[model samples]
Target: DLDDPARVLRSNPETYFKSPEEMYRLFPGREEAVERTLEIAEKCALILQDTGVHLPGFPIPELYRNADEYLERLVMEGLRERIPGAGEDVFTRAHYELDVIKRMKFSGYFLVVWDIVHAAKERGIPVGPGRGSAAGSLVCYALGITSINPMENGLLFERLLNPERVSMPDIDVDFCDERRQEVIEYVIDKYGKDNVCQIITFGRMAARAVVRDVGRVLKIPYGDVDKLAKMIPGPGVTLSKALSTVPELKERYEQDPNVRKLIDLSLSLEGLARHASTHAAGIVITPTRLLDHVPLYRTNKGEVTTQYEMKILEEIGILKIDILGLKTLSHVDKTLRLVAEHEGIDIAMEEIPLDDPKTFELLQKGQTIAVFQLESAGMRDLLKKIAPTTFGDVTAVNALYRPGPLGSDMVSDFIERKHGRKRISYEHPKLEPILRETYGVILYQEQVMQIANDLAGFTLGQADILRRAMGKKKAAVMEKQRERFIEGAVGNGIPKKKARTIFDLMAFFSGYGFNKSHSAAYAMVSMQTAYLKAHHPQAFMAAALTSDMSDTNRLVVLIDECRSLGIVLHAPDINSGGVEFGLSNGEITYGLAAIKNVGVQAVRSIVERREEGGPFKSLFDLCDRIDLRLVNRRVIENLIQSGALDSLPGNRAQKMATLERILTEAQKRQGARDRGQTFLDLLGSAGVSGEIPLEDVPEWDESLRLHKEKESLGFY
Candidate 1:
């Protein structure tokens, strides 16, 4: 009955396994069939053995012996450009990281990442400083794969790649979201297309969603289903847990047979894979054809994808790169371009001063409406409390504003210490240097590793393993790590009790310890956006609006931000507005393509005609010059209603009244031109005369004009 629904419904009522004799007679071959299925499973089961890492070859010149040498040469040259007077410390750190990378045969991995990042930079795509532990590597800084300097930031290379542990060093790259696919295509061309495929991810039905789905399938009322689903409490709460925790759910399950059946079915369906989709940022590039190692399937849009998820691909030794499309990068790229075009000054991202007082001043005021990673309501509130003054403060706040730290007293403690409301003290005097920048609060994973190395006699690599163990909270492993830490500290002449206290503190804080490298990288992006917003409000807001043109809600917010910044927004003008929101005479002009019912082709035609022939003189001039097929009547109507043609000789009401006649005249002229008529012939044509007269009409009322504008622009 549990296995077969058909048998459960079809069995005779009185004789349905009522006794042992009836059960024996019901399914005579059930035991034999089960045995046969087990035999088939045993025969079909295939064991997958671990294979070594497979990375795509870097296209190095034949003069270079290996990728390691090529990587070294690139690093030396990049270092000379990035930091002309970089000293022995930088060289020592770079050489150490290169040794670890070469020993692990990951030199090609670094080269691959560096190549992609360099290509992006050369093509004017904004790449992030870095992400994750990759920012901890000085090699990444030297090779220009990451912009953050590990030596200056005190980031640990072992935290990124530990020689003590044999694991893949994950170096994820962030590119401008608008042009992320272009980078992917560049990579595909460098590596064979068939060798590269995106990874597939599956989504499962959680407890609440499963309950709703099962209830609907059983024809339950939506109100009742929704109430029951809400009763499940928090995320990851199972059906069994909810039934035990909630008295009402328990009562329903015990009293109502229908409720019991529904709950049972939902429990069965919960946590099962509901659908498969592409992983947002994971793409794998194999050394050979991808299909030979993993099966490939086509997405709905016909993009090839691998059957295995990220973890499976990693376990099988395939290199998976996370090419994340970050919208903040797009914002930065657009803002820089607009600044150069409008202000005639090219701003190099790396050359922008990190310690700019104006940027921190904006952050202090919590004026980060569209700033990257720091614009959330909670983060804004936290920022107002912290009143950040330095770049380090910005990075610390970024790390401390996350869920775990915010849920605890860590955020309050950090803020209080930063404002001098609370005394900042370390567990030991030796910890002062490591915790000084963060106000003695263990806000980063790098600090934990540093503490273990400084106070306890542990290598950075061993300290990394301890951090991982504490994060996982595995009881047996944590206990062993705790003993090792204590013994190491005691051997270093520290008292056992103090060591244990510090260990306990480290374990507790490690759970909330954010990656410093990631925080620094993201903080740089946040600072850049904040700096642009404070200094170049108009250009920044225009870029921000263009980046979110498809989202109406975000567009509304950005528009409000522009108004708050005292930057006037002009309506789309046929002669001035580009395909995207652009800066015009120190004001932001609305994008013509952003209007409802208006297409890109239409905007392109309008802009092209205006550019080729000079400013559009009148409605007749626009109609005569533009391709009518691309700029049809509906598009023109949207343009007129949206005030894009306001510079023309007529008001919107007059344009609407005479639109059909204009279209007819424009069509006749276009047909004549297409038929190869001479300019004189065109001039003599009836529709191609000097001017087309409009019907007598009054202008639209203000309220009516606003209403029409709202209809076309999605806002008043």
Candidate 2:
């Protein structure tokens, strides 16, 4: 019956809608088969075993005896370079973190991350300053795994790695999206290829999706399916919930037989795994060949992956690292390269002053079109309201612009307090120091940890646990934590009622508090992009345009931004344009590949031909010198229509008219050359040297010219 669709449908009266006699006739043996199958299933049972952590071993140099010694040596050496004038606090923190890492048996994990990140940096691939709670480690900073200084940022290492809680340290590394593959390949090479594989993820059919999918398979009308699907509200909403809460949906289900059948099928199908896909950033590295432990599968594209998902893989002792590809890293990389190439200044990203006045001015004016994490409309409006003046303001804005804080009155309160429209107050005087940087609003998870430590005398590790309990909102765990927090605060000489109130505030805010380390790291990228825009507008825009070249709508918006910035965007030129939008003489030149139907190989051939022999003197010259196979007739037509051939000796219309003659002559010349004809023979070919008369026509009107441009370039 489970395998028979007809029998399954016959079992559901709403689905079959048959009379009792017809139903019994159709499902004659269904009851006997179901009973037999249940009797057999009761005989089959299995128990799964839990295997402990299987962390991959890090390869260490023979000079070091073990991974621990190598990690310590690297951290100390990196500390010398990261902080030349090392003080007692720096050394003390580094040693303390090293102790905790060694105690937790995470020395090898740290070593592995440092090695991968170091290789990326050595190869000049742009790596983010840091990501997630990993930035809250002084060891990560010193080892060059993360760039954010935890001490200066007031980030606690225990928040990242709790001594009281034993778990795998998660260090998610971000690389430039363009070069992320290269970093992955490097890791695959360092670790044996067979030992590493991307983890598999399953996509489930959520409530609304299942409804529409079942409706289509059931051959229902499109309008009805869409109407039913719309009735399911919110993310992850179930059909049962929708039927109970939505009056209209309930009415339709109760009254319409078809609606009832659809809802029943959707409820049965929802939350079932529909498809398998590779997790974007989850890659697991095993100590030995991967197949020895976990079963493996091949994706449709032939990439090896584990059959187990991330949670199962971790439960069985595999190390999974999130190697995220961030587009902003690519933007920063391209902007820096452009700055060095055009302005003759090689600016180190780390050395740029974080307090640049012009960057703050740009942020204050809300002109952040391409700034990382700050380009959204809501963030821009928040920027205008707050008028940020310092790096801290930028970090605060990044944290507070999210849904939870924004949906509540927290965002408005933060803005008002920062602007002095509202007074900053704290429930307890001890909370003043903790919330001073955020203008007395609980904006970061780190503040929650700080409040627990200062007021309640809980250690940072226990505070992190409290923060987690609040975030998860586990009833039993939260209740236990609440009691402990109140007791601890009372022991520190605070009134019990005041302690309870503070704990409640902490619990409420912890639900939505942003990770301070992550905010600071992301804010650094935002600030870098903003600084480049303020100091080098043309370079920044050109890079930004190149990054989003494939998105036509985005291109239009960026082009408008370019115009507003008083930066001129020149049309594509065969003689000058590269494969990507580039800055030339303070103007942005459209890339040849940005035009429709023009591929990268074609552009490369054109650019190489131009470089080998100087710029094409005419249309005939371009055809004669370049390989026709790559830049064929169709490509030439696009180039001309998109105005890339504007620098040649004719108007677009004239060039269009003369294209056939030019191609015929060039083809004849190319064939002769291919046949080993002498240079004289090629020059003596018919119509090769003489001027080909074109059908003279008036130049296209501005509207027509722009129309052609839009058709070929996807934007005018």
Best candidate according to TM-score: 2
User: Mind giving the per-residue lDDT tens digits that candidate 2 earns over 1-716?
Assistant: 34236763435536754654565576887766544655798879755666566777887899999888998998899889998899999999999889889988889889889889989999999888898999899999988888878888878898678988888888999999999999899989988899998999999999999998988888889899999899889896788999999999999999999888888988888899999999999999988899868899999999999999988887776888999999988887888899899999898887777899999999999999999999888889999999998888998999988889988999889889998999999888999988999999998999999999998899899999989989999999999999998999999888999999999999889877999999998888889889999999999999999888878889888999999999999988999999999988999988888888888899999999999999988888898888998889989989989999999888999989888987888888889889999878876534446345555877899999999888888887
Q: Compared with the true structure, what per-residue lDDT tens digits does model 1 show for residues 350-436?
A: 777879998888888888999988888888888899999988998998898878998999988998998899999987888899999
**Ten consecutive residues with minimal summed lDDT in candidate 1?**
1-10
Instruction: Report the Cα lDDT for residue 351, model 1.
Output: 74
Q: Candidate 2, clashing residue pairs?
A: 53-317, 54-317
Off by over 4 Å in 1: 1-4, 7-47, 234-247, 678-690
**Per-candidate alpha-carbon RMSD to the true structure:** 5.9, 6.5
Poorly placed runs, candidate 2 (over 4 Å): 1-51, 683-685, 688-691
Error of 1 at 620 (Å): 2.9
